[model samples]
Target: MKRIALGVQYDGAPWNGYQKQLDRHTVQDQLEIALARFARVDVATTCAGRTDTGVHALEQVVHFDTELTRDTQSWVRGVNTFLPDSIAVRWASEVAQAPAHDPHLEFHARFSARARTYHYVLYNHPVRSPLLAGKAGWTFRPLDVERMRAGAAHLIGQHDFTAFRSSQCQAKSPVKDMQSIRIERSGDAIVFTLRANAFLHHMVRNLVGSLIYVGNGRQRPEWIGELLRARDRHEAAPTFMPDGLYLAKIDYDPKWGLPQEAGSLLPWFSL
Candidate 1:
């Protein structure tokens, strides 16, 4: 048996979320259906991160074990032929088997991942953007990028992120290593990028909401620290929209040699 890894990208506006559901249109269901069709058998997949509804992905990594051997290019082309226009298989590669479940595999898509990075695109115009609706989050309030960056400082490094997670979060631990959080502006858009070991449900959106509050001077920069210590979700800002969130990148050990930057989050302003 050969283990295969695939790089996936999708616009989440038309689907429920990444996970498969009985009656819902979802990324997982779409991909698995495509895979099962191409491989002529049932195929199960595992991903680095599971995004929520309307949360797009530029670089999502997934792995599955397959008995049939097809070349990488064929895998990409064949899978895409069955996927909806909103989703695409960007790249594919044979990987070390991660069969810990059977005590014989080498890589687990969700387990072998090291870090994930996200980019949130916010349109900070006094007027809403018609072209960007459902593609980017818009706020009429003018945001101060400097203040947003200042607020993001408290969220860097390891800390309990309970206050930033959704009520639906299922992660056992609230403590996560937040590698970086940065805010920058290009034209009328404010972009926030965060890298972390892992994330809880709605964590990125919740954090961005709080930072947006600080950006608009509604809260002090130091308020982020207080929210962390509070460890209460209600103390944080309301969860932001799903449109602006993108799973930009996923990190793995160099040994895997997975393709890098297969699906780019850039051309960001165009969206």
Candidate 2:
């Protein structure tokens, strides 16, 4: 059997989430169905991250093993033929699995990924745009971008993120290495960029929600530091809606044996 890695993108509006559900639409269910149809066998897939319902992905990584010997091009076209319009297999390639370096890692892949990046978009305007309704979180009140950035700055680096984690989170530990978090304004919208080794459930949204309070003058920017120190969920703001979030990209080490042209396969929005 050959192990293959797929780069997938999907419109999360119609699905329950990334994982397969017995009674609902899911990205994994659709992809597995498509893969079974094309390969004529059961295909089990493992993703780098499981995005919640209404959360989109620009370059979600997944791996599966297949006995079929088709080339990368055929895997792309064959799977796309069976997939729904909202989901697409952007790229496919044979992958060489690396030796496991950390048995405690929660993710399934054997490769050592460098980082995972996520982006959140908030529409801060008087009126909502019909076109971006489900694509961007709508915040009618004006936000102080500078204050939000200041709050975000406190979240960077290694920290215990229990305050930002979801109640349903299954992560074994609350400690995470957050590389960076930045909040910036683009036109009438607020965009947040977050990069981390891994994230707890609703971590990004919770952080964003807390920063929103700071931006609106309801909370001081330094309060974020206090919240981090507290490490309690109740001390943080509510988890924001998932509609504005996107799994932007995952970076892997060069030694993972990925294709030389893999960089070219990145989603346009990630660039």
Candidate 3:
């Protein structure tokens, strides 16, 4: 059997979430169905991370084991022909599929991931833009980017992120290495870029909400440090909307040779 890794991009508004469900109304369900039609057989898939409903992905990495042989381009064009316009296979790569006992060499999509980067786009204007509807988080209050940046700095290391975790999260631990958090603003658009080893459910949204409070002067920058030490979910701000969140990238070892792209958090804006 051969393991095929696929780079996927999706709008995420039409589907319930990334994972399959009994109702079969999800990104995974749609992708698997398209794979079945293209290959003329059932194809189960595993993703690097399962995004929540309405959360988009610029490039989501997924993998599946198949005995059927096909060229990489065939997997991209062939599967995409059966997929919806909102979802498309951007690229494909075949990786080493080693035995279960020797997992170090095997390239499991989720397990092999080295880090993840998420981008949260916010529209800070009194009047919302029709063009950004369903694409960005909106706040009528003015936000100070510098304050947000100061608040974000408090979360830039390995720590227990229980304050930012959702109650529904099933992560094994709340401790994660928060590599960096960069906040920038261009015109009315504010973007928060976070890179980490991994994230807890709703962690990014919650962090953004808390940072928004800081940006709006509702909370002091030092409050972020207090929240971290408190480790209580109720102490933090509410979870921000998933509409603005994008799983921008799932980083892996360079040896894998996945054809991924690099760009600003928002394609148009530069930090």
Tens-place lDDT digits, model 3, residues 21-62: 999989999999999999999999999999999999999999
Tens digits of per-residue lDDT, candidate 1, 35-119, equal 9999999999999989999999998899999889789999999999999999999999898864557743487779888899999
lDDT (10s digit) by residue, model 2, range 5-102: 88898889989999999974899999999999999998999888899999998788888987889989899899999999999998887876444784
Which candidate, 2 or 3, has the higher TM-score?
3
Clashing pairs for model 1 are: 97-105, 97-106, 98-105, 98-106, 98-107, 99-105
Runs of candidate 1 exceeding 4 Å displacement? 98-105, 262-264
Please list all clashing residue pairs in model 3, or write none if there are none.
Answer: none
lDDT score of model 2? 0.83
Q: Could you say which candidate leads in lDDT?
A: 3
Which candidate leads the pack in TM-score?
A: 3
Off by over 4 Å in 2: 97-111, 257-271
| Model 3, backbone clash pairs (residues 3+ apart or across chains), number | 0
Model-by-model lDDT, in order?
Answer: 0.90, 0.83, 0.93
Which candidate order results from sorting by lDDT in descending order?
3, 1, 2
